[model samples]
Target: MLLNLPCTIAPRWRRLALMTLLLSGLGTSHVHAFVLDWSQVTWNTGSPSQTFSDVQGSGIDISISTTLAGGFYNTPTQDNNQNLNLFPDWYSNNGASSYIDVTIRFTRTVTNVSFSFEDMDRGNISGSRPTRYYWEDVIERANGWNGSSLVTPTATDVGSNILIDTTSRPGDVLYRGNTNLNWSPDGSFTLNWEQPVDTVSFRYSSGSRAQSNPAAQVIGISNISFHSAVPEAGTLWLGAFLLAALALRSIPRVPELLRIRTRSVSENS
Candidate 1:
C-alpha cells in the first residue's frame, strides 16, 4: 500500500521556496549598496604660507601659492615652494620643511573623520625630484595641551602629499596621499584641544633640482568635503529580507505537520 502525502505540504514548501528567492535577491542587491560622500578644499598663497578657519562650516577653503623653483636644498633636488599654513596662530615653521600646525574644534564629541589633499601646483622640473607633502589632523585630549600629544593621522610619503606625482603631466587627482582619521562622527572637524578635532595639513617639495625648474610652477586641487556615514537603503532592505527568511525558517515544524495531517484527514473524509 502506498501512502499519499498531504496537499498542505505543497503550499508550505512553496512559501519556503519563495522566501529563499526573495532573500537571495535582497542579499545580492545589498552587496552593491554603498555611498561615498566626499568634499575637498584648495589653498594657494603669495606669502610663504597662509591659514584659513571655518573650512567645514562655511565651505572648504582652497589656498594657492607661487611655486619657487630650484629651491630643493638637500638630497631632494626638486622643490616647489607653495605652502598653506593650516595653523598660523599656534605654530610657526619654515616653508615645506617642518610641520604646519592645525587646530580642530568640535562642538560635540566625535570619533572618526577622513581627509584628502591635492597638489594644486608643481615646479617645472625633471628627473627624480623628490616632491613631498603630508596631511595631518591633531586632536586635543585635555586642557592646556602641549605639543605632539595631539593625536594625528599617519603621515603620507614625502614629496607625495595627497599622493600626486607633480612631475607627471597635470590635473591628476590622487586620493592615496591624503590622511584619513577614524573617530566618532558626532563632533566637528575643527581643532579645539579642549574638545575634539578633525583637520588636515599639507606639505610638498621636490627631490632634486635636476628634476625641476627654478621658475616652474605646479598647481592642482579641486575640493574637500565630508558627510555623516549612513547605510544605503538597499542595506536596510537586505537586513529585513534576511530577518524575514530566518523567521520563516524558524517556524515550529510541529504546527506545520499538524496542519498537513488535518488537511489530509479532511481530504480523505
Candidate 2:
C-alpha cells in the first residue's frame, strides 16, 4: 500500500536520508569491547599524577596518582606497567608511605568488566628474597581490613608472587595490603566481578620497613576490558527514525524552491 506524497523530496535529501540510516545502523551493530590499547598512553617519567581518558577508544578513563614522585607508570618500554609485566610500585615511609592508586572508571555503567593486579609480590633487590613488609592495599574499600594477621611467606622474604599471609586476606576486605597472592602468569589473582561495576580502583603502599623513607616495590594491573551495554532493538529503531527525521528537516521548504522570474532592461532605456 504505497501512499503518493504531495511534494517530491529533494534529490540531495533522498541521498542524505539513505546515508544517515546506514551509518546509524552500522554504529549500533558493531559495538564490542577492545582491550585498552596502551600504545597511545603517554606520560613523563615521573609525573605524580596523570589521567588517560577514553583509552583504546573505550568509554573509560585510566588514572594514576601518587604522593611521592615515581609513583606508577610504564618505563620507556613499559617495564612493569600492566601488559603482563611485573607491576612496579611506590614505597612506604609508614607515616609518609608512598601511596599509588590506579583507578579505571567508565562514564556510563557497563558489564563484563574485569582486570587484574599482577605480580603482587615484594622485593628489596637486597636479600635472597625480600618482601614489601610495610606494604598494604585495598580494593574498592579503603581502610576496611578486619584482622591484623601478617605473614612473611618466604623465610628470607625476597621473591615474586608469594602469598604474604595464609588467612583473612584472600576474600577482599580492603587493605594498606600486606596479604594477597601475586596472581602472575597473566592472572591467578584477578578482579573478575560477575556483576557490573562503574569504578574499579586499588590502592597500595610500598616499602620494606615503616620507619625508613619509601622505596620501590613491584606489582601490575592488567588491561581493563568491558563491553558497552548494547541498545535495545526498539531504541535502535527510534534512533533510526530520528536520523531520518533530521534528513527530512534538511529538505528545502516550498517557498525556497520557488524561482522568481526577472526581466532585464538596458541602462540607456
Residue by residue across 61-136, what tens digits does model 2's lDDT show?
6554443333554432234345533233453344223555444455655555666555554323334225334343
- The local lDDT score (0 to 100) that residue 185 gets in candidate 2 is 50
Number of clashes in every candidate structure? 63, 14
Per-residue lDDT of model 1, residues 61-109, tens digit only: 3232222222321111112322222221112112233222233332222
Q: What is the C-alpha lDDT of each candidate?
A: 0.33, 0.46
* 46: Cα error in model 1, Å: 15
Q: In model 1, which regions exceed 4 Å deviation?
A: 1-7, 23-203, 210-220, 224-269
